[model samples]
Target: MAPSWVNDRSYYQEDCPIYFATDFRQIRNSLSHADYRRINGGNRITLSEFYKQYHKYIMLLYQNGRELWSIQNIEKIDLGDVTEFNRMIFE
Candidate 1:
């Protein structure tokens, strides 16, 4: 089954991954603070089960991180607007 979060249909935008990161953080907190069970649409799952369910999204986030890290020659990269650049990179 496809991941529940992929419904957004905004893959390449900065907001898409930001939403995924926030949702993943929430899942992490729920697992940590609530008996190690992930709460998903009223369905509770163990850590391993959670990983199986979200493996695709997890891998996508990992790949995005790798791509971000692969950026070289930061000074040579031209960002037209500092605010937009910060929003894209930091927000």
Candidate 2:
């Protein structure tokens, strides 16, 4: 069956992967704080990489409308407005 995170719409390409991530657990796991930064954090996405895979970049926010994580096609982005766009999505 398709992943529960994915709905019946093509929000992503054909079958983009879904991720359920957390910050507290990462801290407990001794992961670097950089990776755990909020979705609005700086360098959330790479310009060069995004341009290279411009056809596969999509982001989804979840969980109390707090988290912002990338989904499939996560390399392409014509829109450079991460904060504005994300705010719109989560707001």
How does each model score on lDDT? 0.58, 0.40
lDDT of 2 by residue, 56-78 (tens): 33333333244334333434544
- Candidate 1, residues 1-91: lDDT per residue as tens digits? 6566654546433433344555566667775675434534244344565565565678677888898756665556666674356456743
Q: How far is candidate 2 from the true structure (C-alpha RMSD, Å)?
A: 15.8
Worst 10 residues of 2 by lDDT: 19-28
> What is the number of backbone collisions in each predicted candidate, taken in the order shown?
0, 5
Model 2 — TM-score against the truth?
Answer: 0.17
Q: Which stretches of candidate 1 lie over 4 Å from their true place?
A: 1-26, 31-43, 80-91
Off by over 4 Å in 2: 1-8, 11-13, 17-46, 51-58, 62-91
